[model samples]
Target chain A: MLHTLPELVNQRTTLVRRGRFLCVDFRLSVGDVDYDITVNHGRLVGFTSDGGLLRSWRFRIAAPAQTWLAFWQPVPAPGYHDIFALNKSRLARLEGDLYPFMSNLRYFKEVIAIPRDFNFTTEQDLVA
Target chain B: MSASLEPIVGRYLRTTWQQRPVRIYFEEAGNGIPLVCLHTAGCDTSQFRHLMTDPAVTDRFRVIAFDLPWHGKSPPPVGWQDEDYALSTDAYTEIIRTFCRDLELVKPVVMGCSMGGRIVLNLAAHHANEFAALIGLEAADHQTPWYDTEWLNRPDVHGGEVCAGLISGLVAPQSPDEARWETLWQYLQSGPGVFKGDLHFYRADSDYRDRTALIDTAVCPLYLMTGEYDFSCTVEDTTRTGAAIDGAEVVIMGELGHFPMSENPVKFRQYILPVLDEIEKKSAPKS
Candidate 1:
């Protein structure tokens, strides 16, 4: 069970390869906690929990923990289906340089979706 | 079990009403009467990729779509940074005029969605002489109150993500996963602030409530079809707009959304085919 997004990205080689040309950096804000991630030459080179905001990053996608839980499901519901859907409904926020985020949208979307394959569990839905 | 036919993709350079050099990207497929398609705002000509390839549609119509000046493969006009890139009625109408004239599409059937939908009505009102008919998908006279543009333009807000999020809501609730995802992907790939720029026209600049009277359907047939899930341009809203225009046809598409043409092309085609058939029958040579 992959517990964190950083760990999930590092393990997904194919996903990383799919985004090799996306030599940009972005952050994912899960609830109040922020994870700084970097994709360099199609490799997941940096995945760290930053204490402060990484202002230099191309974009920062922030959503509530509950929103992310629904989104990461193998099959997501209406509001959780797409990151932009969340933004439309005011459930999530995307801030910073939008060009890189828009231009390389598919690469980042797949990269974020990698964790869905991992059977991770939180206290809310832990089977064990 | 589908036959594949590729569209001829090309670029056209034109000096738009904005007096800037703009490269408009376009795609064309099939033959027969010309049918020029306009993409939703913030998206490019690629939204019609599947429609252009559909043999059923292509056999009787020459389908064409073009990227607006700043959307898709077409970059912003020179000195774009100096002025805010809000899509005005004049600029929007002029681009369409120049595009059709440049291509020599005699009496083409014009179709559009969302922002494109709104503009086609304007095209009918002012330039009815140019087109044979007008098809407006998700067309409305005013923007819904739910569309909040302030936060979307904030400096810290990621324009792309929020744009995708907001626009994704308009996709039909039952749209195919691939089709829905592909529609959202267009918003994700749009140029920075392009969606917002387009919305400036969609939300505030493009109200046709009073002006709808000017749309003479006899001059150019008017048809408005809105998706059931298009909360922004709900069926009621579209019907209200259609009621204002004389001889305008109105339709409500079940299981479709604001981005119906792209979100579910098959369903959209089903709705559109009958309308096209009617147009062809009416326009057929009177023996």
Candidate 2:
């Protein structure tokens, strides 16, 4: 269900602009795929579905497919609401550099919430 | 719970332990034993808004919730911004003490969540005679190492949104959308850097690991409760904190979050009512 995240990220301009002052790299691991994203001066310069560049990013925020589904809900419940809560409860893992992730925390938070705007009828819509 | 009983709102004017002029916002309802409720860091008196109106609580005891300085309706102390508002253990304890003293609340039962939860331990340790009992909701001896405050204090960062996102994540997934959003709205409305300032005390200054031994339950009973979904202060954390304090009763709330009382009032009341009943029974004189 998380396959369309890259396309969604590219379509959201305001989300990108929110991180304008942030210049760093990060990764998002959903289910089995890893999405490597790079932002320079708050602009998303690169986003790829390839798992090979996993270690190149500063940090990776990873959660299970089910967890991401709940998080991307229009209004998430407790465990899926925030990335930090996920980490605190041991539901999600944040690895590698945490500086960029924390410094530009709001930008990344809003960026991740972009999926709430999408309409999905089934789990396959996110995966396919 | 009743829709009819509303709290009488008032301002508590008192000098902090530091002797700063502070006006604390408070709401109280019902009569009997005083239950002084404290909200989590970055939150306000509204956390106990429902409890204040609940007859099950008010019929047996007087419930009160107050906003700390730099939070909710309470403005920050004088020279707050230039010096940056920081809540130390002494300052936190003193404010609670001063508020109770000024209100002439004799031996009130104190309960708090998160930062407020942690502070109650200090209140028990240092001010045993001041309260009838202590309840720490989501209380723990220390914050998990996963929490980091570095970026939270950054001038360039929009901390209010980030703080809201961080806190809103700890609410139960089964909670009503209205309840969840209402919780989030409070975080969103918090002052700039206020959440982070509170975190400085919550994540850093409020560690009770070395001090829990000071709490003597014989003088005042202590109870600790944590939500199943509270990742920050998990069941394990609260359990360990309970073990540290002698004779402290620990309860793990299922399908709840950090902000139990505010997140789901009806569900939270189920857990709280029993504890309040026990306290009232103990206070009753003679068989």
Candidate 3:
């Protein structure tokens, strides 16, 4: 099963359990910025946010049974040159100066572990 | 029974070490080797909707067209990154390789249009022996100046709008009816940023010239076609682009533009049928 940081500060957070899925909600300091990430059996099944924004990114991680998924918005917009200067001095400065601030932004991970035997009702259930 | 569009469940075929997402669409018929059909950039497998439903194409080859992450039904990669650079190309190439390996597709004929055309070129160049043949229609060459500029990134630029305009112009029932415009508009809305991201990736790419050279040297039979008014890749440019390749065949269809398949289906079929026939003949067992 996958997991996220236990606590998120600078943002209002809520975790609600709906049947077998866990829905984690986040309302960012920036008004109108909110997102809900859904997890099932420790894997990320889907994510929904304002309009088409998060939906686009969510599709990238919704694959492979045991794979881990994470999402975050980079800080200071990483100037245009950073794209071409990844191996140069600009990247070093950006990594040291800006990365830590954005570290707490938001993220998700898919852990590798099968549900206990008790979680299974039958072979058909397991297949389902 | 004939094949239907019901979603088929399958594993994520990792194309590169990075493991990009590749969804495979399967057809029930066909006994010969599978054919990989790569769709244009803006549209997904839907671009080949007509071809997929046609008995001629499907009965002859088990055609498969995958959603490149950030386009069509596929999701965009986590975070915003340049979509046109070598990184994006590498990721896409990996997706194709992985899809073929996981699905056990052997000697598949890789055909693509526009961005899909660029992809087929990359595949043939990097993994020459993986595909049986390569065909590019109005394919964007790497050396083209598409990357060095960002024409679509303007604040007012909306890909959905551009797509709607292009579709309205290309498709018949030629009235500027609101319903048709709205239909195209709705289709464009599903993945706006993804299209923008792909455009960014295209502009950032710097290896088209090198890859084009590699495709020429790979010694694979290459077929290239472009419409009369294809602004993306002119016939002159495409001819010069594939000049280095020993046996690369080139055809320029008249009275057509960027999308000959959509603009002139009859002529498009006339040109492509002979090629398909040739592929089927060669792929047949030797007596």
> Which residue pairs come into collision in candidate 2?
A1-A126, A1-A127, A2-A126, A19-A42, A20-A42, A77-B173
Candidate 2 per-residue lDDT, tens place, B78-118, comes to: 78768877778878888888888888998899999999999
Candidate 2: segments with Cα more than 4 A from true spot: A6-26, A37-47, A51-59, A63-82, A86-128, B1-5
Score candidate 2 by TM-score against the native.
0.82
Deviation (Å) of B268 in candidate 3: 1.5
lDDT score for residue B239 of model 2: 96
Which regions of candidate 1 fall more than 4 Å away from where they truly are? A1-128, B1-5
Give the residue spans of candidate 3 off by over 4 A. A1-128, B1-31, B77-87, B140-157, B166-187, B216-219
Tell how far residue B12 is off in model 2, in angstroms. 4.0
- Best-performing candidate as measured by DockQ: 2
Q: Give the DockQ (C-alpha) for candidate 1.
A: 0.08
Interface RMSD, one decimal, each candidate: 5.9, 3.4, 18.2
The better candidate by TM-score, 2 or 3, is 2
What alpha-carbon RMSD in Å does predicted model 2 have with respect to the real structure?
4.6
Comparing 2 and 3 by DockQ, which wins?
2
For candidate 2, give the lDDT of residue B105.
92
Clashes of 2: 6
The TM-score of candidate 1's chain A against the true chain A comes to 0.80
Best by lDDT: 2
